[model samples]
Target: MNLFRLDASILPGASTSAEIADAAEAEWAAAHPDGTVTRRHIGTGFFPSDAWTLATTAGFTPEADHSPAQREAVALGVALAEELRGADAAILAVPLYNFGVSQHFKIWTDLVIAGGGPATPLLKDTPTLLVTTLGGGYGPGTPREGWDHSTPYLERILADVWGADLTVVKRELTLAATTPGMEDLKDLAEQARTRALDAARAAGRALAGV
Candidate 1:
């Protein structure tokens, strides 16, 4: 039961999203103490974009290449992708910037997905759990729902690259008013933490087939 925890919280403490991710890891460790856990925190920042080198390696000509720095980029992406593919289960916790995932997560995602890596789709059959936190509200079916591209894009990329189905647990801070409704949102966030932990445990069990 290999567990990979991807934490993308930019803040230091009291980050609701990171908290949820931690809860998930805790549950995984409890369920499989012998299993190893790999934690990748993107909040430390990225190592620049490696799309150019990766593109070149994928058969793109030098005319299409951007810079020589791509060697660094593609190497990092390939390493990360390899790590992701070998893992049995994954947990991604990222805060939604504006209306989507931050550039940090996106960078990692791009590398892990197909066409960016040497082999493509880091993990072709492993299931991934994405726990995302947003600033405002937007559930399943609504007029503004289409504005949300996080889950849909994530699902598409994961399926295309990893051939794995992603279970997205999106936590939107649903407070329209500036004065009130924050407490309610906090409550919801706490529940999300619990849910994340439970989900991680369940994912571990499923991965272990026990």
Candidate 2:
């Protein structure tokens, strides 16, 4: 079995998303002790900002006329797409950044689409776990209600577009414990964290088919 995990948290040391993902991964690992694991950390291993553009343009140009950069970009897109298609299961740890998807993740997703074609179901029927974290709450009745713009897009890409058998574990108010003026929300943040972690473990087991 093979498990592909992608982490897109810029703060590796203090990423709530990663922490929740860790809980999920640990469960998966326990179930698949001999399984191979593949990792991609876009937060640290960033793609070239222009790579997507080059890859997109290369699709329109003949292979014989492709520039060196375009060829490389095309190869990268294909490789990224292959990672998802090849995986038996996948875990994506992505955090809300500035109320939306970060540039690093956006670039990676675009490159994957460029390589796989918009209609391709790269993860068809694959069990996948999506763990997303938010520093602040944006639920109904919150001051920032309707402000979260990352989760839906991620769901669309991973589940709707890729055709993955998806499970999402979300943790909100992640910064309540540390952010000023959020002292009152710390307890709620902890509760959210605990719930998310528990959900992650269960999802991981399901991903492992255990």
Candidate 3:
């Protein structure tokens, strides 16, 4: 079995999303010690800003008429798509950035969609685990209720658009411990984080067909 893991957290050690993903990956490793794992760190080496535009244009152009730029873009898209296609399962660990999806993840999504051949869905019902972390609370009755825009958007693409059998694990109030004015919510944040990690581990084990 192979696992394709994409991490989109700019903060390496401080990222709650990454921490949750690690829990999942650890479970997978325990089940399949020899399984191959491919990791992509979009937060650090993000896709080119123009990658989406180039890929979109490439999709519209005929292959015979493709220019060097279009060819490059198409190649990039193909590579990204191939990575997902080859994996048995996938983990996408992303964090809300400024109330929206991380730009890096958005670009990667666009490239993957553009790269899928005419007859194939990008994910084709692959079992996918989406792990996300939010700095502030956005659940019902919270001060920031309905403020989350990233998670829904991600669901729209990963599940609705790409046809992935998706499982979502989210941790909110991640900034409670470090961000001023959120001290009162620190305990709740820790509880949420723990739950998210446990869910991740369970998801990973399930993905391993255990």
Best by lDDT: 2
Give each model a TM-score.
0.74, 0.99, 0.95
lDDT of 2 at 177: 89
Off by over 4 Å in 1: 49-68, 113-119, 140-144, 174-201, 207-210
Q: How many angstroms is residue 45 displaced in model 3 relative to the true structure, after the best TM-score fit?
A: 1.0
Candidate 3's residue-wise lDDT over 29-73, tens digit each?
899999999899999987777777887887778889888888898
Against the true structure, candidate 3 reaches a TM-score of: 0.95
Q: Under the 3 Å rule for N, CA and C atoms, how many clashes does model 3 have? A: 0
What local distance difference test score does each model get? 0.65, 0.95, 0.89
Top TM-score prediction, candidate number: 2
How displaced is residue 56 in candidate 3, in Å?
Answer: 1.7
Report lDDT (Cα) of residue 149, candidate 1. Answer: 62
**What is the lDDT ranking, best to worst?**
2, 3, 1
lDDT of 3: 0.89
Error of 2 at 130 (Å): 0.5
lDDT of 1 by residue, 1-210 (tens): 788788887873756677656666666677688998777888776545546345445445463563555555556666777778778878777777767767777777766542344446665677677777766667657445756667666666666656665666666662322436466566765565567557655654454444
Report the C-alpha lDDT of model 2 over 68-152, residue by residue, as the tens digit. Answer: 9999999999999999999999999999999998778899999999999999999999999999999999999999999999999
